[model samples]
Target: MAASSEEFSVNANEAIRISLVQPGPNNRLITKHEFHPKFTYPIVGEAEQIFGYKGLEVELLFAAHDLRPHLQCSYVKKFDTVGTTSALDLNKTFGNFLPPTAFQQGFESEVLDDSKAAEWTPPGVCVKKYTRGGENFEVWAGSLLDMPMRTLVDNIQIFIVFFIEGGQFINLEEVDWTLDRWRVYLTYQKASKTPTPNASPYLFVGYATTYRFYKFQKPPKDHIPISFPPTETITPNTLPSRVRISQFLITPPYQSSGHGSALYQAIYDQVMADPTVLELTVEDPSEEFDKLRDMNDFDNLEPQFKAINLKIDTSPFASMDRGRLKRVPTARLLPLDQLQAIRSKNKIAGRQFARMVEMYLLAQIP
Candidate 1:
């Protein structure tokens, strides 16, 4: 019986068919692509396996534009209980990951109604629109405090667990001030043929999120401290802030398609254009994202670096400093003040600026 039971087990990631679905002709849903989840341990269990089922397949579908979701669980057979063993409770297991609405009987109908997708322009303002490979794309961004943006993120939070290893959901009950720190950006493909014939052309591609944290500014050397009232309506935006790229995910189909670069540049452009933002930083980024950042950051700064003739001064004793001192101070070896001005002007974090310098120096070689 133990050996027989082994046949009923299935790997959670493999058994789940996750898709970004869109409407085809006549308002019929069609899968854009089917991809397996990168991680399911958060949704299922640490073991990431399901037992007491055969031919198990779980369908987790998201409406491409709005990310409204639908879940359908099906299997060929369930093992008979011997003592206490039985089929895995699919609903109870997935309920933790999906919104409660996904399990309701009529929930699937909400997504099947292609009318919503047709009329859906991405929520919030269209911050950017560009053409790539002859297809038009738009980037829409809004404060999460807004109901539409909040609702949109609530619908899509399930992707964080599927794609990011240790991703966790954002708490929805936070106060307004905390919610104001969050900004969500969604990327969509503008209608090529209408989303449905004669429908709005927006189609979901990928998204990123960001938040602002206080960036302390040091006062002048001769400045004196002054006390102020405890509460005088000092909003978070009033002070200098570091624009942090918190969560960035370009969906599977859009990855490696230059969409990542476009989205990243858009964020950087937005941050730099804002006078209140001190510098831009990223929360812990994945290996892939690090590469993306490095490539784009260099591209943005390279022209300025060349225009200013930025390069390392290899000659430490060119001014006879060896005879007067034990070592060359870093400030003298490189023009620190000038580099700081450039970095500040560009709103790049310090360490990122240093890395960009290295990349600049390497490019100067040969």
Candidate 2:
């Protein structure tokens, strides 16, 4: 018999809150086709089951002062509506799909108190891995520190302890889009009580709303009106659903370190212990990412770690029922030389700005 594994939970004594938020105007929405809704598919089998049947497995690790580590993963979920097949009701269910670039608009933030300064809190903490509600969120270390290379491992420990101990996970709202899960806002308060409406007097560090998706064990009966089809009538297999990494990211300052590998290993071990998982899937394969495989990056991490693309959909499955499946495609990485050429093509300032945006958007190590 296998050893019984222990489940971990955050300290209840700590007030770290995880809540849901509403979507805002600045966010973008996009429609995806041929993907599955996550709620319909349960990852840890039935209630009390140790592992998930059809969802994602997330792990985190903390390493050196780097704050950001390279992230790696095999599959994640894709949620959106299709023309007819596996369709999800938009207005009735999910409000709208946001585009990737919608939140690119940077918002100014103000420190609530003097203690929030850099000396008290490290600046520009690199975001090596961030995933929540289908949004690939990322932040760079440069933004955390006025002067780069100022981050220290000790400071990160202090920050993490403070956040974990305090109810200030909301502070993450400053740079993270997923903070929307919690209806909490982290903004700078203006001194003037009669501040002009919508004026630029104070900074909007973070809003209290965000767009997101949720998977349910079963569609509620009462909530299902006659106009809408009942979810229970739909068989589990036929239930419009897809497996996804609802939230997956390598903890900052801990990426490339053994943390990513350790986290993946834990996930693999947990999944293998469960019997419900079918064949896992990973979308678009990237040559750059594949190189990581050659380095034994994930060896001993999982039982069967395979990498393929759309071409292999027809192949017979060995672990199809619980492991083998499909994946979304990965975006291609441009050559450094070519990227430099494009950056230098425009004015020096333009090039610099473009680089900043690129680094902010794509520098996620994982």
- Best model per TM-score: 1
TM-score per candidate, chains pooled: 0.90, 0.20
Instruction: After the best TM-score superposition of candidate 1, give how far the Cα of residue 228 lies from its true spot, in angstroms.
Output: 12
Q: Please, what are the lDDT tens digits per residue for candidate 2 over residues 1-366? A: 432222221122121111111112243211111111122112222232222111322221111112221111111442332233232222222111111221232211111111222222223332233343343322222212223222222122223222221212213315343222211111222223212222222211111111122222444866754475442231232233222211122322223544333333333333234343222212222342233322332232112112111112233444356443443222222234433443333111233334343443343335
TM-score of 1: 0.90
Off by over 4 Å in 1: 4-6, 80-86, 112-116, 175-179, 198-200, 224-235, 318-326
What's the count of clashing pairs in each model shown? Answer: 0, 52
Clashes of 2: 52
lDDT of 1 at 336: 87
Error of 1 at 204 (Å): 1.1
- What is the alpha-carbon lDDT of model 1 when measured against the actual structure? 0.80
Which ten contiguous residues of candidate 2 have the minimum total lDDT?
A: 28-37
